[model samples]
Target: MQDEDRRRYHDLRPDWAESYIRLERAASLIRTYEVQFVPGLLQTPDYARAVLSVVHDDPGEVERRVGLRIRRQALLDAPGGPRLWAVVDEAALRRMIGGRELGRAQLDHLVALAERPNVKVQVAPFHFDGHAAAGGPFTILRFPDRDAPDVVVLEQLSGALYLDKPSDVEQYRRVMDRLCTQVEPLDRTAAILRAIRAEL
Candidate 1:
């Protein structure tokens, strides 16, 4: 295979994609949980473009990044997407990044995603004391395959870190569980989204 082909294959490899893929796979097997922004797998393209546009200078590069995000979402529709459980901060829902229409669309998208059989959506209200996300947004992916390693993907301002170490992954898992417990349930989350849309 040519160098580019090799790279593409590597990117497409089933065992794992990157650190994120490993984490995502693990998330798929068991229950995966997210806190902060909507999980990448549930993000809408317009919301993604608006988020990416802030950091990327080149329009082409921005589009590529957006495309990558959309592709990442495919895992949600795959034969067995993980049992996706996401706790989104109220601030994230209120932030008007892509204008009212796009923001409304994103919220609508979230409502739809929450309806999926294997998916759960929760909302962490800003008024709650324990609602702050530690180290920003992070996901703890647990795999049904006991042999597969649990993974955590932490997003940062400069880049992202993928953690597979038992200790670190365990810590993130606890954090995710705590956040989920504190948030409103799926139906309430959808209601919150509706209220946000009404205001927009």
Candidate 2:
């Protein structure tokens, strides 16, 4: 895409999302726990469009948002990209956005991405009791620079919340640690994804 498109992407984001994006691009490690739909960083284009369509009626706006999401995904494969670790709840897989075909493709994409050394995808099986992050989806961004502080992002319906205080960051960090323990491991993650895809 042209540099202008990149600029437009930045311009389109809500102020809160724009703030998180700034930290996202700078973080050395991005840890996410999603309970609903697929995490934005890992979403497929069609899936992303299906998501945006629910709230946005304008096709042009949906396409613009999808373009931005897909473009953001490139950083996962870019040189010296941040290491991504995501724990996705089984509910997200079962939700099946954009119909079966699109959902299947999205699961396949997740399984493929897990193969990368820097990317980790896990599933919190349906059997799990009392989900650690029952509040909703959130992400923690960590930078390599010790001088930089870690931040937590809490996404809401119309805007986003950023947490930068040490105590706030630490609380989410503990939640993430406990959350990871509840999900399947790397090997099982791939198998779980494929099994879900088969059902789709």
Top-TM-score structure, candidate number = 2
Local accuracy of candidate 2 as per-residue lDDT tens digits, 1-200: 34786588866787887787778888899999998888888998999999999889999989999999898888898888899999999999989678999999999899888899999998998987776788889999999899999989988888988899999999999989988886687789988999989988
Q: Looking at model 1, report the run of 10 residues with the lowest lDDT sum.
A: 8-17
How do the residues 70-103 of candidate 1 rate in per-residue lDDT, one tens digit apiece? 7667777778667777777788888888799998
> How many residue pairs clash per model?
2, 0
Q: Give the Cα error of residue 142 in candidate 2, in Å.
A: 0.2
In lDDT terms, which candidate is top? 2
Cα deviation at 198, candidate 1, in Å, is 0.7
lDDT of each: 0.71, 0.88
TM-score of each: 0.82, 0.95
Q: Candidate 2: minimum summed lDDT over ten consecutive residues — where? A: 1-10
lDDT of 2 at 133: 87
lDDT of 2 at 118: 92
